[model samples]
Target chain A: MAVPPTTSRTAAELATQPACWRRAADAVPATEGLPRPGERVAVTGCGTSWFMAQAYAALREAAGEGETDAFAASEFPTARRYDRVVAITRSGTTTEVLDLLAALRGTAPLLALTADPATPVRDAADALAVLDWADEESVVQTRFATTALALLRAALPGGREAVLRAADEAATAVAEPLPAALLSASQWSFLGRGWAYGVAQEAALKMREAAGAWTEAYPSMEYRHGPVAIAGAGRVTWAFGPVPGGLEEAVTAAGGTFVHAPSDPLAELVRAQRVAVAVAEARGLDPDRPRGLTRSVVLGV
Target chain B: MAVPPTTSRTAAELATQPACWRRAADAVPATEGLPRPGERVAVTGCGTSWFMAQAYAALREAAGEGETDAFAASEFPTARRYDRVVAITRSGTTTEVLDLLAALRGTAPLLALTADPATPVRDAADALAVLDWADEESVVQTRFATTALALLRAALPGGREAVLRAADEAATAVAEPLPAALLSASQWSFLGRGWAYGVAQEAALKMREAAGAWTEAYPSMEYRHGPVAIAGAGRVTWAFGPVPGGLEEAVTAAGGTFVHAPSDPLAELVRAQRVAVAVAEARGLDPDRPRGLTRSVVLGV
Candidate 1:
């Protein structure tokens, strides 16, 4: 008899990241409602999606696309005028995103990238770019978040090559073993710079959601401010993208392990997801149902 | 023999916050380089000042004072054009702030708000607003951060009254005895909404910097996403502004203490500063000089 697979819904979802990213990136050319070059843009989301929005905003601005700002959907500045507003929601049913989309209907053209196309966002958004293939059954998001960011990344100049490289890296990361330091660390700090800061934030969130882990995220430069005080013995500080000068040495001096790889930041995030799942299994928690969370934050019924 | 004063420099600095706020609010008219109404403004700073910038930016936009954005000094976008750029550096010598000020000399009108008037920023920025009276002897910021924010707040519509009211509340908060629960919490999570989100971030920073406490911060609404997974016994979640609906009950359900005060957010920040000092004293640490930190981050000096 074949051994029953112990893989959780989240682990299965995590495994499909490379393929999902490739599909999303490949579909960007035919997709509509992406912000045009030189158009001022604002991106909004909540939770995991918010981090993706931040990454996309930083990536877009760094690409010389235009000035872009990212905000939590609930905190979206209504007074500010932007040429385009992009909303990222995995479930297409978060109350805050829907409310913002409805509020912005008359003022700014709104584009929504969601995993589910048959939901209320279809009517709320002015334009919809649905990634039905990336939708997940797990409560803790994995593929959908990366797929949304991949779609946005692919829309920018030289974005396709970056996405393809990240996808290739994700494939290798999925099969590789996680570092022993990453498996049972007492605490973790995820650090990133520019666009990668969003990836760092997502990595921290994944640990919290999947394994009830005490994790934190910060801009690589900001990590030195106060958070580094906690970086001693049995803790890990992982950086996405380029490490700031002297950071690794500082963490080492504080007796904390520092992890970095040459892989693309998106691929780095895939490895983080695997760690989250592994940690969850070690703790006897089910990644498919993260404690005290829902698939979507649908407030007020 | 007379008993020597044991009051920490941070405590003394904290004690003067209400007065500093009043002075800064009253001095707004004479304070040049304040961002004007109907101007697109961006504020930049590092650490505590960065949190204050976020507070000011959100407050500015909420006041219908045109679009405003806040960024970490190291992360400021040179590609984006703004009508005005405000850099907050208490020492006026931070490498990142000085670099940005020098780089933005001609492109956009630059404003440097600092406690020190005689510094390189004097040569770098086009305009200067000095709050030398609020400058602190302690390495951890208290008065200057609040005072600078007061100046920014007082420049907005109906701002003086708000600042004056907050000063009065600060006076009360400064005198009151802190709750016993706040003194011994093993871990903390600070939450805030809108402009108060910045206050939450600062509160968490103060705990970490002053007492070596493990703390985290997030927009109040975003806390439910994943961070709350670790919010159990001996952990505290404090909200600077109005508690989100059902959040208090949820945190309580998770066996965590929730703290919310009726005082203005700025006044609430004063109480948090007191907690920082008390925690530092209990841990036999000096708030006057945080570990691995200088008054200003002067890199490569």
Candidate 2:
């Protein structure tokens, strides 16, 4: 089966992606040649890619003008109403992504964030921002997830510049002495509320696919519903941003190991990918590139 | 390491309990002994027990005059909103169920349903519906789940006499030529919209916990966001009553199998429980007896 070739790369290979990091950092900017106020835009992706789109919508709403909405690549046509539809496909050749863009034809402006600028999805899009640079060698997503988060953060209003700065800062942090909290945990659960709930699902899906770990994602308070009964000292409960509705307290009482990124709405989009990357590295596994996986596409619908 | 006792029994055993079934059924007409309308009623249980409460709430709503809410044993206090609560502890000793009732002590009326009439939860309840007659040896929950469903159905307005009449008919159907389609190659995704989302949650939780199968429960259209993308070919999607928007066509277009329960809500509850029972029996597993687990108190504050 050729084991699908590990796309996750070690820290050493990751260090070589300065130019790629720069591009990812630049992609989410609110400068010239980028989206403007009231310019109808559509963001679409599959799995974590789509979650990044959601984080973008939330950041925009928080910023007070970025009128953006997210659509699953499969559900875009009916749900999207925009002058330009941004198609975020890492692999560039996922059957559904290609089929969707083809269905849209030239009816609207199409953009692609892909690993391969020359692949079919990018070819379908009117413009492309490639993330192939930060992609990993392992079968899971680490670099790409962070890169997508960085791009969304940069693109959100007010934080546009902050996002780019954070992306660079985040990239640097992954290589530094971040706490090794997640490495020893046997299982992980992503907790989010409201907008973050959707992100939790995608994060859980990514964690399982990338690390071969058993993970579940849920709304924070929903944990007390029965899932909390399973939590104990060694379990990890990673929380996303906007810790609304007394969710953190519920997690604490459940006796779960907890970690959080600040309440920057952008944090939720990026936290999982960043922490997972560092944890993978600490475990002596590569997060930059995963094995038998591509920076762009694998098992994605 | 002794195997846990089963709470499920054969359809034959349920047939012998016609008297208790009739009493619970006939009690519905008087409404004299039941809690007043709008009184706080808290329904608590795990897996199938939770589903039975959901069925009761739905029927109560459709019959147009009861205020009841269902909560997982762990979610009791946070979402608690009743002046009177009914605790459905089948064994009368499920650790969490007992704890949940205790947590609500003094605040509302408590009704306990148990196979053990002398169990603590029953002794604590303002009233008790003893279901000791529906005992079984199966670790899977067959007879009890169905009996709970039947009792709830009989307890609803206009349902008292009808459900009792239907119970014998349902039992006959279970014993007769019902197509034995348990564990179809098709994975099942149970969906209920709005208030029924809780029911969906219970269905997925029970199916996975009891059968160790991959099952999901979500709001009908909410599945379209991401999970639905992977659903196709070998997946069965069941929609509870009052189909949600966009679901009918979406299921068809996605190449997924779909089934809607028959018109009579009580009958639907009856049938769904039958389907679950049939699933347990076909696997040669006792639905009545769960292994290495006990029905006990689950505390929530």
Candidate 3:
């Protein structure tokens, strides 16, 4: 397959991920309303933001900071009590996140982690951690979500040292040539484990939102349980982190291509973002303004 | 799509769900080591059993039971501590579940919920809850999972009354004719929220395992986030619980058929099981013996 032209805003936004990661990681100490150590926390967001929240929750839990849960903004559990609720919205205007923050205002210490603190979430949340530098104009989010996750990752046990290393790796990921097969596969399955599972889910979302592709995501080990049944010719199974011992063999036996990048999972995510844009360009679609979507899902707008 | 013959072992197993429900619900009172009221619990399983754990966790939490978490057996966190760990595995010998149980044997109260208590789980878990009658010969599980969940549900706040009601609904579900479109669709998406979200995930797994179909699952509201981009003619989006008001319209606008059944979510799950078999038969496959699958995924078997 020819290298498709990547001229869209999404392409440019995605390419800046490395710089965004570094900046976000540096801003972590200054970010207000962040979940404190030992607090029981629940994070909520929509679309790409939700996937990022999942990554942050897993990272926090794995770091042994506290019990952290992630939910799609609309599906936030009202019955469960948490010490703090963090809402992630790139535009800071998604109705579900705003409504949830509004509803939980008095019940919990509501914190808004968003690209724009000046938006409606200002009144909805008790406090704000603004990342306006990572905000995007593209309907398909690329840098903002990862930047937010990078910031959150810096707050974990490994802190700035780990995120800085990831940013350095991402610098290479952004400039590298993608696997040609990824551009032509008819279907894609992205798999990971722990925090990487959320990255895998975000990778699949980028394929669907930017390229209108058939894509699915799962915890790497869970793929063989049933989903491997769909892995055949013209399909690709991409693993974000360490490839499970026999997964490559399983996918190969099923006549599917398997991809595993040794890059940091966040860095692998950057490469996947590039593939989304290239595939979109090849399909004659605009990754900047995806069909049947808007910059922010402001319902009834 | 002419009514595909349903003579497989999975078909017979699924048909007995209502009876299984009644027996499991009644047996709940006699079951050993069930999570007590206000106890923090974690449910772990693999494949179909894992999805059931998710449903049970959500249901328990919604009933205002103490915090309940679900994890795939392989993904169970070693860092987290719970009052009780519930392992759901029909085979009673899955390596990951057994490993988890063995690891937690003394740390927490270990409860094994399985088809046959005589298996390795008897030694691995501190307590055993047997439902051997619901054991299945088919690789594609239909009855064992629901029956196990029914047992768990009986311990929650509405208990037996609600479960027996759902069993009655399942009685109708097993006998109803599946939608013709479901049999012919080239792709499928199952959508649900909370506990039902897990059921939807299982529904999608059923499609892929039984028919080698292109299928996906998501939180109903999250569907529009990105997966909706895959919806188009020859695809079906089925909802287990309430269809989010505009979801049907959105799926319709994307040129896909939408299915929403008013039956209890468990009952709706039974109907999905039947559709899996029907679609498998239509594609010259057998649901009882899905490709690349075994009755028990005993590693290195």
State the fraction of real interface contacts model 3 keeps: 0.59
In Å, residue B238's CA in model 1 sits off its true spot by 1.1
Q: Which stretches of candidate 3 lie over 4 Å from their true place?
A: none
Off by over 4 Å in 1: A1-6, B1-6
Q: Which ten contiguous residues of candidate 2 chain B have the minimum total lDDT?
A: B289-298
Q: What share of the true interface contacts does each candidate keep?
A: 0.49, 0.01, 0.59
Query: After superposition, which runs of candidate 2 have C-alpha atoms over 4 Å from their true positions?
Result: A1-301, B1-23, B27-33, B61-63, B78-81, B135-137, B145-153, B161-169, B172-182, B193-206, B244-246, B263-301
lDDT per residue for candidate 3 within B209-237, as digits (tens), equals 88878888899988887788788899999
Q: How many residue pairs clash in each candidate?
A: 0, 66, 0
lDDT of 1 by residue, B1-301 (tens): 1112447888888899989999998899897778888999999998888999999999999988888899988888988889999998899898888888888889889998999999998999988999999998788888898899999998899999999999999999988888878888888899999999999899888988888787889999888876777688888999998888878877899899999997899999898888877887777887786766667777664
Query: Higher-TM-score candidate among 1 and 2?
Result: 1
* Native-to-model Cα distance after best TM-score fit, residue B55 in candidate 3, in Å: 0.7
How close is every model to the real structure, measured as TM-score? Answer: 0.96, 0.52, 0.96
lDDT of 2 by residue, A1-301 (tens): 1112234554434344334545766655432224556665667776667776765654554455444556566545332346666676767776556777887767777777777666667568777777777665544544565465566556656555665555455555434443445656766778775456656776665554444344677656455444544354677777776554444555566566777776433334344554555455544655543333334433332
DockQ of 2: 0.06
True contacts kept of 2: 0.01
Query: Tell me, what's the RMSD of every candidate?
Result: 3.1, 11.1, 1.8
Going through the candidates in order, their DockQ values are: 0.56, 0.06, 0.64
Compute the lDDT of residue B59 as modeled in candidate 1: 96
- The interface root-mean-square deviation of each model, in the order shown, is 1.6, 8.8, 1.5
